[model samples]
Target: MLEVEQKFLLADKTALLDQLAQLGATQETDQEQEDLYFTHPVRNFAETDEAFRIRRIGSENRVTYKGPKRNTVSKIRKEIELAFESGQSAFEQLTEMLELLGFHPLRSVRKRRTPFTCQHQQRAFEITIDEVEGLGLFAEIELLAEESELQEADNAIIELAAYLGMTHPIRTSYLGMLIEKETQSGSD
Candidate 1:
């Protein structure tokens, strides 16, 4: 599936929440997520603009692969995710298996996320407000679509973002921002 998404750095959390409420969006349970990114043994994922990560939410574990962005506008990419067994033991086994195969853990991004969902123009969009550790707050509007529905999905995301008064959509991924920050800190 194609993941069409736009992210913004939130300047005012309350205002965004109020706008969401005005749109009749329903908020879902808050979740704490830890995504551990990995580096391939022979290839550079950063240069390739790809990502491989294992995300742990509570006892559930998911491995996700995000391909390069297909366009310059939004984060339109192909994503494939698979779920593993639910437990610490399963999580460890998966980690060990990856390590044995030469994948090295790069870093972990921790965030507290609250998700909201609403329908716009007969299409459903999932919006998330994330407070990333070390990085500030961000809001993302996302829609999963098939190849044929890319244009419609992109339009819906742009319209919803404008409705929320969110300008200057950030194209950088959370992992990329974290890495940039680390690079700057180390240089200083």
Candidate 2:
């Protein structure tokens, strides 16, 4: 399925949360998650966009391949699983498979998600409620679907920002930004 998701960087969590309460946004679940994304084992994948990931959050272990949709994606995956271990082992081996497919690994990011309880919302824009860890109650509005909907999604985000009295609208991907911070701190 085509996915459209965007992250809104909020400054005042408490204030916006209070506004959310006033707006009738109900609390749902309070689950935390720690995510770790890895690259496919294919050496050439270092330059491609395909990603083979191993997500370890709470007690769940899921291995996912976020690569371009290929005709034999499922068939190839079944062959790989039957030939190797599951979870991390399978993820590691995916890199090798990508190599055989003439694809290369590209970017890898690890983000810890702590998503708060978010019931369904009735807003003016299209939103995909992200139940992640570390970040609570994320509003992801993907603009990748109808390229034209980009402006509409942006406007909706702006409205949400105003309604919730939010600030610090971050543009960088959280996973990449967090990793960069950690690296900078370590080097310093």
Q: Which one wins on lDDT?
A: 1
lDDT of 2: 0.44
Tens-place lDDT digits, model 2, residues 139-178 = 4433233445444544555556555554344444445565
Candidate 2: list runs displaced more than 4 Å. Answer: 1-10, 42-52, 61-148
lDDT against the true structure, per candidate, is 0.93, 0.44
The reply for model 1, stretches above 4 Å from the true place, is none
Q: What range of 10 consecutive residues in model 2 has the weakest lDDT sum?
A: 72-81
Cα RMSD (Å) between model 1 and the true structure? 0.8
Per-residue lDDT for 96-149 in model 1, tens only? 999999999999999999999988789899999999999999999999999999
- Candidate 2, RMSD to the unseen true structure: 8.7
Given candidate 2, what's the lDDT at residue 55?
Answer: 50
